[model samples]
Target chain A: MQDQVRSNVVEILTQAIPSLESKDSFALAALSDRAIELAAVFHDEDALGIALVTYAFGKLVSRGGEEKPLAPMILLLQTAVNALSSDDNSAYKKSIQRLTRHIQMVDNKINLYFQEILEKARIKKGSKLFESGFSIAAVASLLGISQWELARYVGNTTVQETQPLHTLSVGKRLKIARGLFT
Target chain B: MKTLVFDSGPIISLTGNNLLWILEPLRDAFHGTFLIPRSVYYEIVEHPLVMKRFKFEAYQVRQQLEIGVLTLIDDAKVAKLGDELLLLANNIFSSRGQPLRICQRGEMEALAVSILKNASAVVMDERITRTVVEQPASLQKILRHRFHNAISMNATAAQKIVTTCKNISIIRSVELATIAYERGLLDKYLSRKSSAEERSSLLDSVLWAVKLHGAAVSEDEINEILRIEK
Candidate 1:
């Protein structure tokens, strides 16, 4: 079952990307997908990762004159849906919150993509309308945004600020520096 | 879909830089798993000082092959990785019965684990990674004979990945990028961007970041910092 899906995704992406993008652009998607898939089987996050890679890839690709379909984009979009509306993944709703900023980050040039993400993030049944702690910085970085631009568009008031635990002591810091594991 | 193998380096870089969030896409991109070697797990979780931050007793990185933290590891498979690692790093690293090669044993085990686990690629952030050093003798042979390799990264690739990663995380925004600099995430970059007097202010900011991101001074933040110098 997974094999069929994998082959199908590769085939579709290969054919469709070429049709919509330049050779280099399509190749980037193809290569990235290939890498993501290999990473996927190693762990299980490949599909969603592909969706996300697609999300980010699409934005980058589009900017490079590549066009993407709303159909396939839905897969990555739906992962967020599953997070919000699905019952099986209830406990993981918090993790699902990640979709909010990613959606905001991607589809930046495209309004529809933003809407899709906002809907999922906002509509989780019974979820409080607020996770006031979500950081725009965290979101922006995850989405491959440039800090210079982020500082401008994301305001301090509307954009949540320095809320998450952000400290590491000297002792812990040195351990990372002493990366030598002998 | 390029396959990326996880070694402690990328994970640490990502985690430190607040790029761990990419694990979301990464986990999703890979269909929800993060693969690593079992020996690697012992290495990551067993550190005495490491306990100060990532409490292994509590958090298991949830992935397809949850080796140590949240998921179960396939022991037989892990041992298989250990075996293959022995071959990959044979001269320098011996898995069994060598007191001097303990670290090599650990590293080889990671490589083998990556291969046996069907990983598309193996990754490591060790100081002596695939680049910036001569290839391991055996791997040199493999690159020569197998693998039709256009996948190598040069500085451009590094910059691209870094830039792309930063954008995805929204850390690349001017405000955040500046904030990152202020926080010492991009120390040298911040310093260079500043006037000579601003350098002092920037250094002061670094001290602030030492306080701000204490345990959280992730690699992305660091990258933002280094970009200043670059």
Candidate 2:
């Protein structure tokens, strides 16, 4: 029954972040239901879990109109998302057991779609960082890629071959270096 | 004149360690032109200036360019060679179904420039590039371990790479920095109150930091450089 709810919520989800709160609860409810199905389509379980966690957190915001401690929720959701993505069903079940610890973390209303958008943004930033000549390991750590999956995405792209624009002139640099040294 | 080609890593290492001042003196002492490929200039000079954190280092390099201690060459001049080398190098490492791109375009351009100019050496700090150019067997072994299989290149292509790499000497920034220190170029910037041991330790720390930052110098190699009797 819970599986049904998880897979039914966000079937029609397609909007980006920034204007998430004004989005009606019907949409949020839909996201919560279709989380698993969305995960399969995007091949990303963690992001959908992030979206769901944020949805729950968003609910508290709408009710009190104040910021709440969402860190614990974020952590729990991340674990659950990873569990879902795992091939082992026993591991997924074991991970979901820890979710009970965050039962009182937030109220029922969540800004679910907002969290999904945030996850997508993080992935985007990860690719950009990799492209900028940062080591693959460093970027992978930052993006929380579990199995060198980021490499496959990044390896396909080639480095941009253009001259970067210089903001500071040579004279200014010499002056600065001299001033700093002197 | 004999030439020495530079990649972006060593230059960035020098700047990051507050040792850009040594370049001019080193260039003045060496009897060869210091060549910087366009891609390298883009990496070390143009890219850094736009970002606030690296603007100062970028400027320091610009000063070197302004003073003619470093000369920029169009990458187009060696683009054909660079691309060929890049393709060959990647193919050599593509032991598994997946291809490994060990060197960036900038690094390839530097290698191209080194070959075209008949450079005395290519001062670079990237481990894979250094290994491929100077020690192909080591690179092949590494690729074998990475792919968990035997890696091989066609005899003709292997011969071609070996022939091209023979004329190119690969040195790390640690060596260049050591050379600069030995020639007393760093004395003006560093304090005189320190003992020789302290100076050596300071140099090791700076070189180690550069090694960590991305230059290919291994910990063992760094230790060897430090233990050298000057």
Candidate 3:
């Protein structure tokens, strides 16, 4: 959450986390985590998810010489949210819906972003894959893909067969999803 | 001009764009030889999660592929770290660098190569995990998107990568997308089209990834770019 909250996160989630908490059973990790506790109160998963996404707003920013600082905790927070969204146990329904929306928005923005950089990394006229001698791995990473996936999806990649993507158990799924999205 | 080292994230994004065909052209197009340290090959190819994709690509570039550097892992620890390292990691501390406690050879080599070459850039999406590793001062360089895309999808940097990749060469965009269509990559892309909501969700991920990473285009963006080119 942005610093503007002003309220004590521990106090707020103390009330909110327990709302879903069973007196006899509880998440020690969650209870112990100050971030979780503060976030637990807003328990409206969707709103909190939105607040976390405020980070991805900048695509590219370059000035004379200052290097960019890491984006605020928002990206890390979203990754955690993504991990949780697929977990049925930890997932609140509202959160998943919100998360799905966020991914869509991010997807929409990636293209514009890529076009911007290709412009900067423009190659000398008439270079081709065979000539560059750059490994496929380098190209794949430049594009934000796993080498395996890159080999599979790229044309004439000579990539192997597609293995089915295994489904995650509900609780585990939500945990992972939460890590990624919210 | 800085040199970039490729990692796994950009590869996955390409499958979505149907741009794998471009690999052939790309492999032929660039001037400097790109690298995929041997350790990187093992992490992405040997691991159960990434293996299928790895094997598929291995066969394609089998003729051209060359080992850049072998990741020096604590042989003893590699066995122990096994699955944990595969899930995703920034760095693993191995007080017990005994046999069976392996760390990612891929990560080590990638870093080592950067340092050895006094290279200025490293392109790794997964490195910003809970831990970090020490490196020679020469190894440090500007992360390609460090200035733009990574922090957020809304930055000016993010906008540029997307637009430029969209226009890379109208002719190549189609050829690349078609190749992706022939492969199962299109299936994964279409399956999500089940709903606009799903489509949008996937799209945002592309936008953010492109901004942070380089011009690694997404399936949706490739499709859109090709359609525009057509």
| TM-score of every model versus the real structure | 0.29, 0.57, 0.28
lDDT of 3 by residue, A24-65 (tens): 112322222323222222222333332222212222222111
Misplaced by over 4 Å in model 3 are: A1-182, B1-4, B27-29, B48-105, B118-120, B127-230
**Which stretch of 10 consecutive residues in model 2 chain A shows the poorest summed lDDT?**
A159-168
Query: B1-230 in candidate 2: lDDT tens per residue?
Result: 86778887678777766777777777766766889998778766786577774677788899999989999999566988888887766555543344445455667788999999988777775545655565555555444533345556555655677677777766657677777666666666567697888788777876666655445444555666677622
**TM-score of model number 2:** 0.57
True contacts kept of each: 0.00, 0.00, 0.05
Across A18-71, the per-residue lDDT of candidate 2 in tens digits comes to 213343444544454344223322324444444444344344444443324344
- Candidate order, lDDT descending: 2, 1, 3
Candidate 2 segments whose C-alpha is farther than 4 A from its true place:
A1-182, B147-156, B189-194
What TM-score describes the B chain of model 2?
Answer: 0.88
Between candidates 2 and 3, the one scoring higher on TM-score is: 2
lDDT of 3 by residue, B1-230 (tens): 22234444343344334333444434333333445455554544445244553465444333234332212222334333322332222112111121111123354354444444443333343222101222111111111111111211122322332232221111112222333333333446557346655544444443433322323233444445334323
User: Scored by CA lDDT, what does every candidate get?
Assistant: 0.35, 0.55, 0.31
